[model samples]
Target: MGWFFAFFFLSGFCSILYELVWLRLTMAQFGVTTALTSIVLSMFMTGLGLGSWGAGVLTRRYGQRVGFPSLRLYALAEFLIGCSSLAVPAELAWGHRLLQSMTAQNAYSSGSYYLASGLLVAIILLPWCTCMGATFPLAMAAIRSRQRLESKRSFSFLYLANVIGAVAGAIAPLFLIELYGFSGTMRVGTVCNVIIAVSAFALTLGGRASARSSAPVLTPGERRAVTAQPKVLLVLLFMTGLVTMGMEVIWIRLFTPYAGPVVYSFAFILISYLAATFVGSFVYRRFNTGGEVDPYLSWVLLAFLGLLSLLTSDPRFPLNTPLRVLLGVGPFAGWIGYLTPMLVDRWAAGDPDRAGRAYAVNVLGCILGPLLSGFVLLPLVGERAAMLLFVVPWMGMAFLPSRRQEALPGTRMGTRIAAYASVVAALALFFTTKNFETLFPDREVLRDSTATVIATGNGMHKRLLTNGIGITQLTPITKMMAHLTLASLPQPPRNALVICFGMGTTYKSVMSWGIPATVVELIPSVPRLFTFYHPDGATLLASPLSHLVIDDGRRYMERMPEKYDAIIIDPPPPVRAAGSSLLYSKEFYAVAKERLQPGGILAQWLPFGDEAVQSSVARALEQSFTYVRVFRPVEENGWHFLASMQPITERSADDLVRRMPAEAVSDMMAWGPAATPTEQFDRMMRTDLTTQKLINRSPDTPPLQDDRPVNEYDMLRHWTHYVHSGMRNWKPDQYGAGSNPPPAGESAQKGNE
Candidate 1:
């Protein structure tokens, strides 16, 4: 019982720690956009597969030998895992910084950032990943040798214990990493390794005097291990692995927009697998010795139900309920865990000594499943389709024959009614909720449901209000706003361009100005989805004068040919995903200048943020262009900047007010708002104070790009800074909880004059 408790805790702790460290480094170094993170995760699986294959060789070569000490071996594996946690972070930081510097200098313009990120990721991942992968097999080998059992009872029982441990390990990271950051999570993991090493050593030292008797070796053919049932079981487990991998990626994709601090997001999955494993193992331990059909029958039923649930459930269902519940407490584990003993019973048959070999092959499937899913299914077909494809092998498990059959004794009448009702209910709900999000689209829609709008700019002309001031004219301009602004700009405006293409309002504005403008957007679904929700948006996107390129704004600027007299960066706030971080990076500024013609004006719109974020951005701009001046349009929350390669002076507040459209003139007449006080301008001027401080205090963490490492913490800090800055600048009834008002519904839209 002592040994059982020790192994269970150690196994769970070590596995979860390994994953937490692995995921953190992957997300940080590779930027959040790529699918390669999945490839790294699958390495742990590969390691398990290799570990399983090598276990037999290890046990046979060292089981009874004096030199091959099991206690020392266990300690060594734990130490390796500890060492991996530290080394992975350092390596990730180093490689990420190197790429950032190279890209910033234009030293590697020939290759895309994605390619560079991938190559750097490969160098860091391959070695540590392989080492991490080796632990599971080593663990299983240690367990089998310690027990040294002849009966199926001991083998099944010990294997069942290991399954529980694996499940526990899988679930631990979700909570630990959340409470503690990744660094703290790794520290917890190190302690787990030490405990495992110490306990194994203590157990071995106590049992040293009792050497097990050697059993006669058996050949593969002599054992009659080539049974059809176990083979079917193996296939079922492997298919489950595929589903598990696909589910993980799909879940992340679905959750990314709504959730923050999503590291422990896979907890549901871990828990579900754990529950299934516990139930399956417990049943097998109770009934396998008696050759009762109940154990095998339960496994079949669980797998069938799990697969059937998946097939009938809508992939884009509004809620993550079914997926989360099944992931935490479903048949995923029943498939992965039950197969191990079933294969052992077949291959080892009556010979307990050869059972180690059967267990190793079972571990191999764990490694292969994720790798195949990441590199093949995920990138080729979307996550939704990959999940649908998992059902084929799971259904095949029904036909396998076994020594016992445990059929339910239910009458035909009861079974028929349940089955019929299930079919009708599933079909009815599937179609009913398919575009359910259109009813209410906002932050709440994302918070409570799975419905994601591909293009938000389309449906309504959402005003971009900052600090209680509207900047609608600064973003998607209407024909009236564009016509007015273009008539006002100094002539030779034939080559005007826009950095953001929100709802094509700015494009309409630019077209009215008679300048051919190009717009860049990151999300591919945005243009199309917006077209569905907003009819006007569809026409603007297909407009003759505008070209909408689905590319990062900074990347597009680096390669674009037009030398525009005016380039409007009417971008959405930095609060959205990676968009905010990319905007502040020095690399982006360098590219922004390269696209601008001499004496060209660059307009940047910014929201209120803390000293750090605001100043960091100001410093970034200062570093890029010679003339950087801040502007506060007459409206509230309307902060703007006109930067240039040439020196420029700020115009008087009265002149700025005078140079407005009629509505803006009307608003100015109505409000008669005071100019920003001298104190506020001084605060704005202090934006350069912390640029050097930030650079010095920051660890040499690389600047984020499509290929750069993503620092979720760093980005979160940026948001926090933004929030604080907003609070500092807040006036009564301006941007806040209930005190400030919400935007009126889509209709009576007043253009940000």
Candidate 2:
């Protein structure tokens, strides 16, 4: 029994590690759109469901006649899963290459692209995920054959250990990836799986009985009971899976603002959820004495808990981020943790086939939940209302009329009262609570499948926020991003490209050069909200000179054939944002180099980061470009990295101003603290920084790469610095006064305007 627990604990750890790594790898290969993310996750769950059901069928038909111990089959499954760690990366790379070739031959629409990429991903991932799903039933069969009494609650026992292991997995991989790259981290998972397989196989070889199970020959009464279990149990399991996973997607969107957009923010949410779930499952295992919990009361509690996030997430509330996540998500996730295995155990009755079927039904709901949330609910109703809709099912289930046989005597009135009270509380929360958008009286809010965008503030204070995190503001800094790089060229740019269209400021500035400017924005709603920030936004957007492509910037560059004289990349803020490394990585620079014409410049806007991140990004640029120049923005504390394959001339302020056209000069001074174009150019030039100076801050730090996102996974480094600084009473002011700089756009003072 101890060995089974250990086996499952390690198995669960490996499963989550694979999920995190694979999802990231697929995003790198495919585009990083919401739809692509949903497809990858759904395919993963689908594979698990198919494997569980198929394994159950095989066990039911052949368990009694098998010549070897069932544990050997479990070991074989683990061995295959371990091998996947090596195979999957190569397979994904091949699929990406194939898609690229197809894309080149035919101009694929967005729908066609998704279809082709999703099919390729499903083909690559399904087999390995199936092997992951089969572990449950195979282990259950082994336990049933060896120990009859333990088999009765084998599912819950394994579930508890798995959840515990999952909690560790949620926190461990961040540090692992920080030390090793993605492929190296995967190698660690492979080694653990191999150890589990070797240990399981050795146990089977040590004279374990190969006997057919005596418990398979069921009596007539037992057979009737097994066949007659209520189908509603399956429905309940499905609902739990759907609601829990859906809420997770919503939580990320709602909490990102308060927690900041770093990778640690996501890890904190997952840790809270999995840790609380472990407690619930542990309590269930300790207390399960063949007694049933009250279904009506449980449903009522879940329905109310489902709305707890509304109160905690409200801007009017005083809770901090960690408190908000814990109070909002903990109780609801814990209740689900308690309910899921209980229903599965009751329905399965120690039969591997029945448990497999029940578990697969749950996984089916898991597969659909994120898709429904990302595609349908979030885009249509937004986060607050979508959460309200998720609660409706649980509320309805709580009020469901009970059959006479199932109803407990004298408890009906209390259950009814609790159910009514929960509905009232949910309604109250819906009516009174204020979301992040409501914090500003003057704001335009828009929702799309990708993000929730809010254009808020007035005059120079105007800002663009996606999913509540402020992206960019109306400032001259954005204008300089276009003019400074374009004017530095000895010859005028023929055409240009802007990667991120935040508030359309840079895109608008680029157009002032009177060249064809193309802007690629990830969020569709962000482009639509341009008119909210600038009065001439609609006019600019309607002009023939402007072209808007709503897609991931890296992906757009990969597929598009047109080369630009200047490519300006202002990746979304915070500098340590999850997936931001993709833009700053060495591989990304290699791609950008391919898209630049001879003597073209690539200007990268890095809002803010610590020494390690700054050094890593600086090193990447230094290695990628022949000539690289770094400048501190005149108004804000951040870098503007200008890199070019050709020599970037060090022109004087007057020379730079002379290079710009009349319209470009006017646009540069439109929102400036400077009185003239030469003054504006001079102010920027005064802050010129060298790439070598930036890299010298952390010489040991390697260049940021696609495989190793040093900026995103810096929790361990930050922690170590915090401890040493505290001991020495040091005031770390390299980037700012505190351990973390103020979130990108927030750092600039209003006086700067």
- Model 2 Cα lDDT, one tens digit per residue, 1-753: 898899989988988889999998888888788888888898889988998898888778877664635788889999999998899999998998898788677666667787888899999999999998888888888887775576777888888888888887777799999999899989988998999899988887774633355556345776677678777788878988898899899998888778877777888899899888888787778787573544576776677798888889898888888999999889998888887888778778667788889899999989878888888999999998899888898777655665632632233777678778888887887788878888878999899888999988888778888888878777788899999989977588999999999899999999999999999999999989888888899999999998999888887887767899999999887677788889999988988998999999999988667778889999999999999999877676678999999999998999998888999998898877788778777877887888999899989999999898987887678778878777455332222210223433344432121
Error of 2 at 96 (Å): 2.0
- lDDT per residue (tens digit) for residues 251-275 in model 1: 4443332222122234544556566
Candidate 2 Cα misplacement greater than 4 A, ranges = 209-214, 217-220, 291-293, 402-411, 727-753
Clashing pairs in 2: none
State how far residue 170 of model 1 sits from its true place (Å). Answer: 6.9
RMSD (Å) of each candidate, 1 decimal: 9.3, 2.8
